[model samples]
Target: MFELAKEFGGIQNPEIVVKLFSLTLMGQVGTSRFAICLKEGKSLYSKISGEYLETDKQTLFKLVSAPLLISELPDTKRYNILHDHLLKEKISALIPLQMQNEVKGVLCLGDKLRGGGYTQSDLEFIFSLSNLAFVSLENARLFNEELEKKKMESELLIAREIQQGLLPRTLPTIDGFEIAAENISSKQVGGDYYDAIPTDNNKFIITIADVSGKGTPASLLMANVQATVHALVPFQLALSIATARINDLIYRNTSSDKFITFFWGSLDAKSKKFQYVNAGHNPPFVMRRDGTIERLSDGGLILGIMKTIVPYQEGSVALNSGDSVILFTDGVSEAMDINGVDYTEERLESFVKGLNGKSASAMLSDIINEIQRYCTAAAQYDDITLIVFKAT
Candidate 1:
């Protein structure tokens, strides 16, 4: 380090900088030929007791003369005289670096067998070394930038995993009924969930909720709410009473500003009975075999909307064969396009009417696809959730 520092301290030429850097980084770099025009200035540097070649090229130009040292060549006597001048001042190169594509600059090292001229092997070695040096520097810069990007990506992936865990891993099985649900979030983590829990003897509970916000906070709150409901569900209770208690739990746990639009219900698979409460949520649609549509939007204020004032309302319906109920979050209704119009309830009702001909899975897939197409090119701002219940 000290040797290079001393050599560099006495060096003062554009080409000398590259010579010093290459030598320091790559072991032994000889023959200083440099030039890369940057916003700072023209850069060309080299080493000492060496011939300094000066040229008028403002930019990097191809080396017209190859393997000729300024000190030995008599043709460019002006270069020889200039080399003498720069050497007196310890300047490494009086010449600027020039290159068009490859073979940008030239520097003649001493010949192998005496000092006739540089051999082809020596020239090849120098060229290879310089190329390696240039590539190494470029690679280092790119690698660092990529490393930072990967770190950010890692953080996002971890967040996504955690968010995913908050959702129901498996739906609860109920006798004499077919139930299935799915949710897809925009690239970032979101606040949407569905859960199946047993509420009482012969009673299977279903919940589809949309928490008000996104990211880690919403996911965390959803987890908290799920735990609370699951813990309370094991006890047999009336639909309204259970929802009221659940709302209080949520209100107590989260801030007044944060709330969830939730729909909760219990289905008696054997009896074909459905009882549910809609807390300021999208109404669940019941499609009968005769092509009749039933909107179940009976509940009161959404959970976390008030500390204790509003009471939750309850409703019930009977499901026979060929009957299906669709429950979803606001993502489907509020979905809009460049025109800024939503996929309103009327459109959704028409979609349900259209899908009466399709099977359960097909109907679900088609509805989601239709909504996505409606909002073409518009980034989805919320989680899209769908739960379809068919009486088998």
Candidate 2:
């Protein structure tokens, strides 16, 4: 016993421990054939040598609790099935591997090679050895799980850094325009994106998008969108043409399950004209100084669903002084309260109507505060992103 304990103390691999335990049991019991069955997570691990037996793990676990001869089993329907199976495989005895009164596994042994039945002393030794091996297997499983958890946490921290880098460090200071934007991710990394890029002709580009899912895959796709937008902005193509190109690239590269809701426009400060395209995105509200609202809704389908079947349509709106364009992802509108009701779009529009004279940054802050107050106790389930452009 002391030698067996010393041999198992240093091993951490479950498979190696099982192999050694099987060999030791066969040698100690003077048996040529044996079977070891242990439960691992949601599945069963079994090892058999010398003779093949079709063992039902659930049945063995349910019926066996103590050491007993297979021939001496009670003649009930359940026990009869196990008895017949053991006899067919020439198995003679059953010993349960237990820890703290709970059965963790079962060990089956065939008749001794020299022809006598197993005694009480032999059964006791076998039980003790089986439990010792089980303890080692459980420890190894726990250690591996901890290592996997740490690896995932490290990867998520790196992903968060990369996602932050993709956002604009400081929005461009466009003449006669006040711009403010904010993005708050959920517990996990999300795919909400917003950017403002300056162009050559006294104009700037404003874009916001929400990718379909969350986590590393979504962040990776968001990075691709950011790269594509920057690469195409230098050419100064029409909003319609650039949008079509982006749609085709995404569709050809990604699978059917992936897509993005996107909205973008070029704001010419001198002309005060905003030429925009909305690709299945939440239609941003153009709130006028007189409390009127116009929703920008003209465009093609969302990106990456399919190829650009029809050319995207472009819409243009002239921004007057005191007019505010409010853009946001679904996270803002779908935010829940303690009663599970959403802060709907109608509420958001009404709230914006009251903030007519507020600065762009103040409007952004008030909206964020309202959403946070509304969802005081409920957990946030998605990314919240908002961008406001006010004509000065």
Candidate 3:
């Protein structure tokens, strides 16, 4: 048995090892037939057919884990059910296959060819053989799991690359204005996005959006939004009309449960007038040089929720020399600390209210630093996106 244990440990194919061990067991115990059942995902499988063999697998599993002598429990209901369902083809002893203190499978053998029950010594030998088979099977399972994990990680890396490429590498320089935007995604790819496009006139368009969900699906939807905005903005469409078109496109393209909170606007360099619409997004704050704050909140429903029911209302504001507009996703306002308290919108407004004199880029950096400080030792759960546009 010790020599056979070494041979079983060397076998690479777990299925082949199981079959070989069963044959060897039948020879030693003089059993008529032998069979092995192994756990696969949520169920147990045997060689009865290509599909799984339907039986009470959980009960059989529990029986093998503890000390059970079938001959001593003839009157028990559980023993009767297990015996009737499992011990077919004249099978007698059922031995447990264990690895790392966990039962991985079961080994069954028919009644002895000598027409008698197995001795105590014979049962112990069967246990040793089952353990040898389990070690080989567990090794194969772990190797396959590692391979699958590596494959998934490689796919996620590719997805992150594509999402990063869609973001602006450089903010389009509009005369008489300073613009800065930043995005810090969580470990899982988040759907936060921002962009700036320079039009034919001195005017340009700026946009910030957050698609629901994350990973490859959200990134793909964001790419679609980018393509749609770039295509329609050049047509000289009004902000309201353009927003309606975007809503229709997203609603038709994705499922009902998926949606995007969006804000976009056109800025006139010569007139210093900003025309915009906010579609169920977190209202952006426009801090005036007079210390008064204006919230942009006049647009229709969120994109992809349903088709445009009514024309999206457009809003406009005139910017002064020292005024700044702050655009952010919920990630900044909803950042959680170790104690699960959100940083909150009030904190963000207070932080920016005192920074009315800083440069656009400096203000962006300081806010991110404050967020990191507040959420110390806690993992970021959502994507953080910020855009600051100041009338210089």
Pick the TM-score winner: 2
Off by over 4 Å in 2: 1-10, 30-63, 85-91, 104-116, 290-292, 335-347, 350-356, 374-379
**lDDT at position 47, candidate 3:** 37
lDDT of 2 by residue, 1-392 (tens): 88887778778787888788867876787765667666546333343342333346677777789987786788888677667778876788888878679887777777787889888898888878877887777777777788888887776676677678899999999899999999988767778899999999899999999998877888899999999999999999999999999999999999999999999999999988999999999999999999898899999899999999899999999999999999999999999998999999999989989888899999999999999999999998778999999999
Show pairs that collide, candidate 3. Answer: none
Query: Candidate 3 lDDT, tens digit per residue, 289-351?
Result: 876788999888999999998999999999989899999999999999999999998999998
For candidate 1, write residues 283-347 as lDDT tens digits. Answer: 98999988899999898888886665666778999999889999988888888887888888889
Number of the top candidate by lDDT?
2
Which model, 1 or 3, shows the larger lDDT?
3
Cα error, residue 101 of model 3, in Å, equals 4.5
How many clashing pairs in candidate 1? 15
Winner on TM-score between 1 and 3 is 3
RMSD after CA superposition, every candidate = 11.5, 3.5, 4.2
lDDT of 3 at 181: 93
CA lDDT of every candidate: 0.67, 0.86, 0.81
